[model samples]
Target: MNQAPRQRMTAQARRQQLLTVAWQLVRQEGSAALTLGRVAEEAGVSKPVVYEHFTTRQGLLAALYKDFDSRQNALIDAAMAAAGDRLQDKAAVVASSYVNCVLTQGREIPDVLSSLDSTPELAAVKRQYQLDFIEKFRSWFAPFVAPSDIPLATMWGMLGAADAISNAVVAGDISQQEGMQELSALIITTIARCG
Candidate 1:
């Protein structure tokens, strides 16, 4: 008996499909289950097909991080735009949006992100994303902050506080609402110190 040939997916479609499979596997079985072979099996594709999209495990992890980063930035941007002109409102909106994203990402994402950082390449990618976020925050908040008040270090600290708060939320150390409130207070206090 002969089997039917598989339908061919466009390059972009195939990449997206693999990424979805990878994320599902991570969510279902933790980050330890995210091998290329497992992803191919879960995705109903050949190992070579997965490899074609991501040359190595590190490449695959990097792609996932980039995808996550893009989605997160979009959410933050939308929230910030919809927020009031006041710095406190803007900060609360942004922090709430970010914490909401983390909460909705399923419990496995934080582990996957941590595991992905084991490699130097992946760690560098993570660091680069953090820097990009800091720059974006600096650009957005500059208008509301005093010129001499918000320096680069302060921007970096703000970003770190956001990440730490999100991590705490993910770790179940605090409720999402609490995390948002705490982060908002930090942001408001930081802004106040700027001028």
Candidate 2:
């Protein structure tokens, strides 16, 4: 579907294209350059058509945020596939994969995260994505604990670290490997001692 004709694209497919274009542009130029006119010109469609697909800039950015989240989720699922019995090991995989995805996507995740908390609209858009990811990560770390022993704040902390690591890496203040190692250590130790 990623390769399908722009004209023949299904609603889902067209949205996917919109997401694809948005990611490329945002990744290349950061979120400031994410404009409907720019996306329309790049996708070879009219501005109104772009608006039809994504009613507002935030709507489009929100959709791209979902796309990035899905990609992160898929990477986690793939990492856990061959993981050893240790839930920490699975988490190490998730950290590495998540870090890699965020680093490679440039500034999309960082931009979204930075914009989200301060801006009500973006915060509302990202709210569910944050929750879903936290639940998934919490479950990944669950086997490290007796189900009754796990603390809720641990989930929140780990997800916050994941976002921080992504932002640091995207800001180029840390290397990708550094981000992965720190995340792996932080999450594993947090689960080990607290869970």
Candidate 3:
């Protein structure tokens, strides 16, 4: 039997390929099984190549998270752009986009997120992403709740609810439709109270 020769990829393309394989490894074997050497082997690349892109396991984990965050942000932004100005429409988009993003990523994200909290540095990275997300929520809903700024605590509370409900949806504890309906109502109610 003859093996096909591997095709050369650009540096950026190779990094993307490695990230894709890393996510696959996490999805198939959980985040605990993710490692540079394992990703290299799975991608049919040498360990050096993986190391070059992600200097350490922590670096790789961070990249994986950032990749997920980037996708989530894009999805939300696009949905928001298409959403009507009504509070109900915006809230629905937020709930749907968030739940759909997590569902699309499957169960691997929670594991990756747990791994990200294992170290201080990774925790900071995750925290920053959370803070950024909260800011986004503030900006999106602030217009509806204008004349009164949404309290930071309120924003945090909303984020907490979103995470919990989305996790429940992903875990099959609640159906996606149920999660979205609950989340949308919570958002509208929260903003209404603030207003």
In order of appearance, the predictions have TM-scores of 0.91, 0.86, 0.95
lDDT of 1 by residue, 1-195 (tens): 999997888999999999999989888888887889999999988999999999888888888888888898899998887888888888888789878887878576687678768988889988899899888877767776656547888888888788788888988999999999999899888877886
Give the C-alpha miss distance for residue 4 in model 3, angstroms.
10
**Tens-digit lDDT track of model 3 for 1-195:** 998996789999999999999999999999989999999999998999999999999999999999999999999999999999999999999999999999999998999999999999999999999999999889998888788899999998998898889999999999999999999999999999999
The top-ranked prediction according to TM-score is: 3
Candidate 2's C-alpha runs over 4 A off are: 1-7
* Full ranking by TM-score: 3, 1, 2
Ten consecutive residues with minimal summed lDDT in candidate 3? 139-148
Model 1 has a clash total of 1
Model 2, global lDDT: 0.79
What's the lDDT for all of these models? 0.85, 0.79, 0.95
Q: What is the lDDT of residue 7 in candidate 3?
A: 77
Who wins the lDDT comparison? 3
